[model samples]
Target chain A: MRWEGRAWVFGDNVDTDQIIPGRYLRRVSYDELGRYAMTGADPEFPEKVREGDILVAGRNFGCGSSREQAVMALQQAGIACVVAESFARIFYRNALNRGLPTVEAREDPTEIVEDGERVVVDLDELVLRSESGEVPLREPPEFARRAWREGGLLELARRNPERPPWR
Target chain B: MATVVERFLSEKCGERVEAGDVAVVEPDVIMLHDGSGATALRTLRELGTERVKRPDRVVLIFDHSVPPSSVEAANRQNELLAFARRHGIERVHVDEGVCHQILVERGYARPGRVIFGGDSHTPTAGGVAALGFGFGGTDMAFTLLYGELWLRVPRTIRVHVTGDLGPGVTAKDLALTIVGELGAGYADYAVLEYTGLPERLPVGDRMCLCNLATEAGAKSAYVPPAEGPERLRPGDADETVELDASEVEPVVSVPDAVDRVRPVGDVQGEEITRVFVGSCTNGRYRDIRAFTEALDALGGPDPNVRIVVVPASRRVLLRLARDGTLERLIELGASVAPPGCGPCLGEHLGVLGDDDVCVSTANRNFPGRMGSVEADIYLASPLTAAVAAARGELADPREELPRTALERVSGS
Candidate 1:
C-alpha cells in the first residue's frame, strides 16, 4: 500500500480538542466533524486540506480523548495518513480501526520532510520518501495493512459478518 | 517482566507477552455511554449486524446526557434504548452517574479482568487491579460483536509513592503533581502501577489516581491488588520511578490543561465563578461525604459561587441521599445534578459561560471541555475545590482544616 501526498505539519501533543473540540462533539456526525476539523487549532485548516493530503507532526499526536471522532474528522477531512514521532495509543488504534494509516517515525519526520513537500508512504516497505531522503519506519502487522487497504474496520466487518472480525 | 497488561495478554494468548506486542483478547465487559453508545450502535448498522455475540457482556448507560440536554440529545438517548432493546442488552444503566463507576459499583470490574469502555477515563476501574481501559468507535463496535479487540502490550511504569499525604492533600493532588513534574502524557501508552501505597489510602483516593491516568497519557493505571482488592495478583513491572510524596500539598491543575499544575497558594486569589465537586474521577460516596464535611466546616460555599455536585452512579447518589450527604450539598447552595456525567462533558448542566473560571473535580480541562471556549477550568481535589468554593477563589484546602480533618477524611 502506497500513499503520496503533500505534507501538513502539526506540533506535538495535538489533542482531540485541537483536532475537533468537545463542543463540536454534539454534532456526532462524521461529516460535520470534517468541516470543523483542526479549526480548534487553525480555523482555516479544513478549507486548506485537499484529498490525499498527509499530516506530519511531532510526538503524541492525538493525545487526548478517546472521542474517535478526532480520527474520523481527519479521515473525512481527506487526511491520507499521519506520520509522527509517536502517537498516543488510543489514537493510533482508532486510526487503524478507521482505516486511516498512521506511521510512527522513530526520528523526527518533520526534520526530514518539510511542510508542503510531496512525500510517499510505502506501507508495504515501511518507507517514507521525500526530497530529503527515504526514512525507514516500522511496518504494521499484516492484518493492519489489510484493514487500511480494505478501507477500514467497518468495511472489513461488513465483508465478514458471520462471526465478525475473523482472526 | 510481565505487567498486569502483559500478564493478562500472555494468559489470553497462552504465550509470553511483553510490552509492545500486539495481541487480541476478549474483554469481560464493554461499557458504552450516551456519547459512544449511539455511535457504537451506528457502527453496528454500518456493519450490517444488529446482534452482538455476547449481549450479556455488553453494558450501556445514559451518563453523558442523563435527563437529556436537548430534544436531539433526548432523541439520541431514546435511540440508544431502542438499540439496547433490539440487541437484548439487559445490563443497562440509564440512570447511572458514569460508566466507569457503575461498572465497579455493580461488581463488573473483577480483579485481573480486562474491561473496555467508550470513555478515556475507563482506567478508573484499574483502581481495583483490573486491566480496565478504553478505545474508540470501530474498536468498540468490533469488540461488542466479536468480544475481542487488539492492544499493544505497554511496558509497566511503576510510580512508587511514599510519605503520608499532607493535610488536605489528596490522590487527585498527587496525580496532578505527577503530571506537572513529569509533563502531561509522560506515561503515554504505558501502565502506571502505584506502589509504596500508604496503608491508609482509601478506595476513593485510589480511584481518583487511576481515573486521571488518562490525563497522564497512560493506557491505564492500577493500584496492585495487594492494596486490598481481592482475587488478583500483582504483576511485575519493567521500569520504576520513586516519588517522594511527603512534601506534597494541596495543588490545582490550572486552566486549559490537566498537566499544568501548580501549588494552590500560587493562584490563591484567582477569581472563581464556579466550583464542581463531582465526576467519575471524584464522585464516589466517600468523596461526597468528605467534601460535604468540608463544606459544613466552611458554613457553606460563597454565595456568589455555583457548586455542582454529580454523583458517580445512582447507587452512590442513593447512599448519599439516605445518609443526608446530598442534603448537605444542597444546603451548601450546591445544585445537585442527577447521577450522570453532568457538566463534565460540557453539553449541559452547569456549563461555564464566557470568561467563567471554574474549579472542578472533572478530568479534562482542554479548551471548551466544560462549556464555552473562552471559559477556564481548574482541576482540583474535592477538598481543594470545596475550600476554593467556600472562599470564592483558589485556596489551599489545608489553609483552615485541622490535621484531624485530613485523618478523618482519609479513613480506611
Candidate 2:
C-alpha cells in the first residue's frame, strides 16, 4: 500500500490528549470525532487539515491514554498515514488494529519534512519520500503488515469467525 | 533466565516464551470501563459477533463518567448496560471505583495472573505481581469475541528502589522522580520490573508506583511476588535503574508534561486555585487519610482555594468514614466527590476553568487534562497537595507539617 499527501508536522511527545482531548471522548462516532482531532495541540487543526494529509512527527507520537479514539480521530480526519521517529506501544498497536498505516522513520522526519510539503509513503518498500530527501522506515512485523492489508483486525476476525489467526 | 513477565506469559501460553517473541494467551481477567466499553461494544457489533466467548472473565466498571456527566455519556453507558445484559456477563460494577482499583480490590488481579484492561493505568495490577496492561477498544473487542489475543513479549527493565522514604515524602514523589530521570517513553514496549521495594510498604503505595509507570511508556509494571519462587533474577532485565527512596524529595510534574518534574521547593509559593487528591494514582484510603491528617495539622485549606477529595472506591470512602477522616475533611472545607475518577480526566466534578492553577494527585497533567488548556496543573503527592491546599500555593510539605505528623502520615 502507498500514500501520497501533504505533511503536517508535530514535535515530540504529542500525547493522546493532544490528539483528542478527554472531553470530546463522550462522542463515539468517528466522523464527529474527526472535527476535534489535534485541536488540543492547535485549535485550527481541524479546519487546516485536508483529506489525504500525512502527519510527520518527532519521537513518541502517541504518548498517553490507551483510548483508541486517538487513532480513530486521526483516521477520521482524513489523515492518510502517520510517520514518526518513534511511537508509543499502545498507539502503534491501535493504529494497525484500525488499519491506519504508521511508519517509524529511520531518521526524524520532522527535521526533514516541512509543514504542507508533499510526501509519499511506500509501505511495500518501507521508504518515505519528501521534498528534502527519502527517509527509510523500519519494516513492520508480518502480522502487522497483514492486518493493514486486511483493513484491520475486524475484517480478519470476520473472515475466520471461529478462531484468531494466531490460534 | 526468564524475567517475571516472561514466566507469567509462559504460564498463560503453556509454552516457553521470551522477550521479542509473539505469543497468544488467554487473560485471566478482561476489564472494561465506561470510557472504553461503549466503543468496544460498538466494534463488537460491527464484527457481527453475537456472543462473548468468555462472559465470566469479563468485568465491566463505570467510573470514568460515573453518573453520566452529559446526555451523550449517559446514552453510551446505557448502551453498555444493555450489551452486558444481552451477553449475560455477571460481573458488572457501577460507580464503585476506578477500574484498576476495583480489579485489585476484588481479587480479580492476583499474582501470576495475566490481566488486560482498556485503560493505560491497568498496570496498577502490577502491584499484586500480575502481568496487566492496556489494549485498545478494537483489540479488546477482538479479544472478547475470541477469548485470546496475541502480544509481543516485552523486554524488562528493573527499577531497583532502595532505602527508606523521608518524612513528608511519599510514593508519588518517588514515582515522579523516576519518571523525571527516565523521561517519558523510556520504557516503550517494555515491562518495568520494580525490585527492592521495602516489604513493609503498603499495597496502596505499590499501586501508586505501578500506576505512574504508564507515563514512562511501560507496557506493564511488576513487583516481585511477596512469597513465591517466581523471583526475578539479578540480570534478568535488559536494563537496570537504581533509585534511593531517601534521596527522593517532594517533587511535582509541571503543566503539560508528566515527566517534566521539579522539586517542590523550586516551584514553591506559586499560588493555586484548586487542590485535588484523588484518582487511580493516589485515591487509596491511605492517601485520603494522609491528606486529611496533614490538612488538619495545617488548620484546614485556605479560604480562597477549592479543595476536592475523591476516593478511589466506595470501599475506600467507607474506610475513611469509619475512621472519621471523611468528616474531618468536610469540616476542613473539602468537597468530597463520589468514589470514582473525579475530574481526573476533566469530565465532571471539579473541572478547572481557564487560568486555574491546580495541585492534583492524579496521574497525567497534560493540557486540558483536568479542564481548560490554559490551566496549569502540578502533579504531586497527597501530602504536598494538602500543603498547597492549606497555603493556596505550592509549599514544601516538610516545612509546613510537624516532623511527627509527617512521620505518621508517611508511615515511616
Candidate 3:
C-alpha cells in the first residue's frame, strides 16, 4: 500500500492528550471527534488540516494515555499516515490494529519534512519521499503488515470467522 | 535465566518464550473501568459477539465518573451495568475506588498471574509481582470474545535501588527522578523490573513506583515475588540501571511534562490555588495518613487554598474513618470526596478553573489533565502537597515538618 499527501509536522512527545483531550472522549463518533483532533496542541489544526494529509513527527509520538480514541480521531481527521522518528508502543499497536499506517523513519521526519510539503509513503518498499530527500523506514512485523493489508484487525477477524489470526 | 515477566508469560502460555517472540496467552483477570468499558462493549457488539467467552474472569468497575458526572456518562455506565448483568459477570464495583486499587485490594491480581486492564496504569499490578498491562478497546473486545490475545514478549530493563530515602522524600520523588533520568520514551516496548528495593517498603510505595513506569513508556513494571508458591529472583534483562536512594531529594514534575522534573527547591514558593491529594498513584491509606500528620503539625491548611482529598479505595476510606484521620482532615478544612478518581482525568469533582495552579499527588501533569488548558499542575508527593496546602505555595517539606513529626510520618 502507498500514500501521497501534504505533510503536517509535530514535535517530540505529542501525547494522546494533545491528539484528543479527555473532554471530547464522551463522544465516540469519529466525525465528531475529528473536529477536535490535535486541538490540544494547536487550536487551528482541525480547521487547517485537509483530507489525505500525512503527519510527520519527532520522537515518541503518541506518548501518553492508552485511549484508542487518539488513533480514531486522527483517522477521522483524514490523516493518511503517520511517520515519526519513534512511537509509543501502545499507540503504534492501536494504529496498526485500526489499519492506520504508521512508519518509523530512520531519520527524524520533522527535521526533513516541512509542513504543507508534498510527501509519499511507500509501505511496500519501506521508504518515505519528500522534497528535501528520501528517508528509509523500518519494516513492520509480518502480523502487522497483514493487518494493514486486511484493512485492520476487525476486517481480518471477519474474514476468518472460525478463529482469530494469531490463534 | 528468564526475567519475571518472561517466566509469568511462559507459564500462562504453557510454552517457553523469550523477548521478541509472539505468543497467544490467557490472563487470569480482565479489568474494565468506566472510561473504557462502554467502548469495549460497543466494539463487542459490532464484532457480533453477544456472550463473553469467560464472564467469570471479567471484573467491571465504575470509578471514573462515579455518581454520573453528566447524563451522557450516566447512560453509558448504565449500559455497562446492564451488559454485565446479562453476561452474569458477578464481580462489579461502583463508586468503590480506582480500578487498579480495587484489583489489588480484592486480591484478584495475585503473584505471578497475568492481568489485563483497559487503562494504562494497569502496570500497578506489578507491585505484587503480577504481569499486568493495558489493552485498547478493540483488543480487549477481541480478547473477551476469544479468551486469549497475542503479545510480543517484551525485553526487560532492570532498575536496582540501594540505600534509603532521605527525610521528607517519598516514593513519588524517587519515581519522578527515575522517569526524568530515563526520559519519557527510554523504556518503550520494555518491562521495568525493580530490584534491591528497601526490604520493608510498604505495598503502597511499591505500587507508586510501578504505577509511574508508564510515564517512561514501559509496558509494565514488576518487583520480585513477594509471596505465593513461586519464589523468584531478578534474572536476565536487556539492560540495567542503578539508583542510590540515599542521594535522592524531594522532587517534583513541573507543569505540563511528567519527565521534566526538578528539585523542590528550584520551584519553591510558586503560589498554588489548589492542592489535590489523591489518585491511583498516591491515594493509599499511608499516603493520606502522612498528609494528615503533616497538616496537623502545621496547624491547618491556608484559608486561601482549596484542598481536596480522595482515597484510593473503599477499604482505604474505611480505614481512614476508623482511625479518625478523615475527621481530622475535614476539621483542617479539606473537602474529602468519594473513593474514586476525582478530577484526575478532568472529568468531575474539583476540576480546575482557567489560570488555576495546583499541586497534585496524582501522576501525569499534561496540559488540561486536571482541568482548563490554561491551568498549571505540579506533580509532587502527598507530603509536599500538604505543605503546599498549608502555605498556599510550594515549599520544601523538609523545612516545614518538625524533626519529631518527620520521624513519625516516615515511620523511622
**For candidate 1, what is the DockQ?**
0.54
- Give the better candidate number (1 or 3) by TM-score: 3
User: Which regions of candidate 2 deviate over 4 angstroms?
Assistant: B231-235
Give the total clashing residue pairs for model 1: 1
Q: iRMS of every model, one decimal?
A: 2.0, 1.4, 1.7
lDDT (Cα, tens digit) per residue for candidate 1, span B312-385: 88888899999988887777788988988888877778888987999988888877778777888999888888
The alpha-carbon interface RMSD of model 3 comes to 1.7
> Which digits, one per residue and each the tens of the lDDT, describe model 3 over residues A1-167?
78999999999889888899877776445347889899878889999898999999989999887888888899989998899999998888778778888889888878778888999999888899999889899887777778877878876766664587676
- Give all candidate RMSDs, comma-separated: 2.8, 1.6, 1.6
* Clashing residue pairs for model 3: none
DockQ of each candidate relative to the true complex: 0.54, 0.71, 0.60
TM-score of each: 0.92, 0.97, 0.97
- Model 1's CAPRI class is medium
Off by over 4 Å in 1: A1-7, A109-142, A163-166, B14-16, B198-200, B227-231, B402-404, B410-412
Task: Identify the runs in model 3 with alpha carbons over 4 angstroms from their true place.
Answer: A27-31, B226-231
Candidate 1, clashing residue pairs?
B97-B340
Pairs that clash in candidate 2: none
